[model samples]
Target: MRELELKYGCNPNQKPARIYMDEGELPITVLNGKPGYINFMDALNSWQLVKALKKATGLPAAASFKHVSPAGAALGTPLTEVEKQIYFADGFDTSPIACAYIKARGADRLCSYGDWAALSDVCDEATARFLAMEVSDGIIAPGYTDEALAILKTKKKGNYNVVQIDPNYEPAPIETRHIYGITFQQGYNNFEINESLLDNIVTENKELPEAARHDLLLALLTLKYTQSNSVCYVKNGQTIGVGAGQQSRIHCTRLAGSKADNWMLRQHPKVLGLQFVDNIRRPNRDNAIDVYISDEYEDVLAEGVWQETFKVKPEPLTREEKKAWIAQMHGVSVGSDAFFPFGDNVERARKSGVEYIAQPGGSIRDDNVIETCNKYGIVMAFTGMRLFHH
Candidate 1:
């Protein structure tokens, strides 16, 4: 089909929503459910992210997207036992793509709630089973197996949005959009991210290990599709945290750092051992655990709110405990879509265990930033490529 109409735009009041192609048929087919404007936005952007991830890593990839930004993205990697428990899949021999999707969706389940999913590889039964357990709006992938299609068809009472796109489809080099009767045009950003981008190591510690390089590539690929003024923290083939669309570089670092800290805090013994009521649902447990770990726990704890989510009054995860747990985190990689004008970004990222970094590295105070990395023995590379997205 050349065009597909939508029920509405970003909101219900916006009328006459549709997507079309000028010279050829649209590259996707809607197998189920009616996708909204925002759903399509999430799917298209996330699909690009996963596609880049898989191409960069030569592994299956997935992304959990909300609005137009990714909540998490990951490449296929073996999940630890603790990770399987938290992700709620303990006994399954998950496919590489399935594990990638689980890690992507599980990175921040709270943020991923009702998210749109995108997969790099064809959807398999294992991936469908994992998706079945999550709260999601829709999914977009290149293809789906028969078993996977059957399983996904049962989601959302058989109305789940399932989109299949041409794996080899590529858009024209230029793109255009309109806003308020004004048309905007630009060349599509097809900048390739690869090992060659990590050649310029300005830090005294000139060590971007193979794993660290892979993590750095993951972060850069994620930032390519993220909104402007974004930073991403990655570890072990997954984006642990992403801060997008911030005004200040330091704010981006701080925002992503806090999320990285939360990711680490979730694996803390106190958090992992929390005893919930026998029948507490996964979503409720996620919320309760987040609340228990936050500094605002006193507010949630004061009114006996814990009783609703936990069987017993679990010990509060105190600020001190949080600090101690975060301190132990290491081997993290950070990427910036643009240059860090000041050393403060480095200072904040270090607090969240960022040991390696990649950025365009043309700031006026590049020496200061390099000195800061030296203090922490952090290895940093100048990719010399800005990944600003809008």
Candidate 2:
């Protein structure tokens, strides 16, 4: 098709929206519902992210996108028993593509409430089954298996958006856009991220094992597609935390670090043992868990929100217990969209168990930043490339 119409633009009042190709026919086909302007924006950006991740790691990849940023991204990796439980993958040791989807969805469930999903490879029945259960807007991929297509057709009462893009399609080197009756042009930011970028170790501890390198690469790839003033924390082939569109670098660091810490805190013994009512919904459980992890639980519990979700009222997770559990978290990798002008970012990242970092090293206080990493025995690299996406 040459063009596709939309219900509206980004908002309800922004009327008369459509997407068309300026050169030739559009390369995307919608197999299901009509997608809006923001849906297309998220679909296209997330498609590029998973495509690059698959090429870099040679593994199937997936991303869960909300707004224009990714809530989470992951490569094909087997899920442990604990992971299966937390990701609602019980009783299904699904395919590799399915595993990737679960990890992507589990990154930050709260943010992915109505997300657009992207896959590196073809969608299969295993993956489709997982997606069918979530609260999502649509999905985009290269292709879909017959069984998967049949299953996805049942979601949202057959109105869910399903898109298929040309996997080999490439855009022009120079891109253009118009804003407020003015034209703007720039070269595409297609700089490749690979092992070579991880070669420049700038910390006292120069050891970056293969697994750490994979995590660093994953973080960088995620940051490349994220909004500017972003930071990502990745571990075990998946993104644990992503802070996007913040105005300050320190705020980004702290936001991502706190999410990373919460990811680990969920695995703590006290958290794992929390019992819910026999028929508590997944979304409700997710909300309860978030409140239970945060320090505000003492106040929330007093407000009587806990009694509705749990079988028996559970004690709040204490600050001491949370701190002790967080201390045990290590081997996490963090990536920044631009330079860290101060060592305070490193100090906060250390509190969340960050042991490896990747950021453009252009700050005037680079020495102090390196010194902070040295104090924590962290390994850091200067990629010399800034990834600032709008």
Candidate 3:
């Protein structure tokens, strides 16, 4: 179809919304449900992200997007037992694509609620079964198997939005948009992210191991599609944290670092052993886990909130325990969408176990940033290319 009508624009009060191509049919077909403008925005942007990840890593890729920013993104890597439990993959058939999607959504379960999912590979039954259990808005992929399509059709009371994009389709180099009756145009961002960008090591530690390089590349690719003023933290092929659209670079670093710290804290034995009430909803369990990992867990437990989620009132993860667990977190890789103007960003990232970093490196305080990395023995590279997505 040349154009697809939508119920409304970004908000329901807005009127007359549709998407069309000037000279050719749209590259996507809406297999089910009427997706709104924001859904399509998320779908298209997330599609590009997973596609690039697969190309860069030669592995299946997936992304969880909320409001055009990815909550998480990851390549298909076998899930460890702890990973499988925390990600809710236990007892489910774990295909490569399924593992990628699980890890992506698992990166930040709180932010992934009602997310738009994107997969690099065709949706198979294995992936569909897992998506069926999550709270999501819709999904986009190159294609879907017959059984997978049938399963997805049952989600969201049979009104879930499912889109299939042509894998071979490419947009024109120049892109345009309209705002307040004014036209804006620019060449599409086609800068490729690969291992080559990590060549310029700027720290005392010049060793960029193969696994660290892969993590760095994954972080950079994720930042490429994330909102500007963003930072992403990656480990073991999946994004552990992403802070997007923050005004201050330090804020972005701290926000992402906090999320990374939480990811590590969840793997603690106490957290893994928490027993939720029978049939507790996935979202509720996720909420409980978040609160349990935070400093407020003691307060919440005193208020008797655990009765709602857990069968037994679990002991709170103490501040000291959280600190010790986070200290053990190492080998993380971080990427920035733009240059870091201060070394403080590096210092904050180091607290979250960041051992490798990738940034454009155009800051006036480059020496200071390099010095900070040296203090931590962190390996950092100046990619010389900013990935500022709107």
Clashes of each: 0, 0, 0
lDDT of 2 by residue, 1-390 (tens): 788889999999988989998787888999988888999999999999999999999999999999999999999899988889788789874888889889998988888888999999999999998899888999999999999899888999998999999998898899998899899999999899998998899999999999999999999999999998999999999999999999999999998888888889888877888999888777888888999999899998889877788888888889999999999989999999899999999999998889999999999999999999999899999999999998
Per-residue lDDT over 1-390 for candidate 3, one digit per residue giving the tens place of the 0 to 100 score: 899889999998999999999989899999988899999999999999999999998999999999999999999999999999999889999999999999999999999999999999999999999999999999999999999999999999999999999999999999999899999999999888988899999999999899999999989999989997899999999999999999999998999999999899889999999998999899998998999998888999888878988888897788888888899989999999999998999999999999999999989899999999999899999999989988
Stretches of candidate 3 above 4 Å error?
none
In terms of lDDT, model 3 sits at: 0.94
Model 2 segments beyond 4 Å from truth?
none
C-alpha displacement of 274 in model 1, angstroms?
Answer: 1.2
Best lDDT goes to which candidate?
A: 3
Let me know the TM-score candidate 2 reaches against the reference structure: 0.98
Model 3 residue 223 lDDT score: 91
Q: Cα lDDT of all candidates, in order?
A: 0.91, 0.92, 0.94
Point out the worst 10-residue segment of candidate 1 by lDDT: 84-93
User: What is the lDDT, from 0 to 100, of the residue 27 in candidate 3?
Assistant: 99
RMSD to the true structure for each prediction, in A, is: 1.0, 1.0, 0.7
RMSD of 1: 1.0
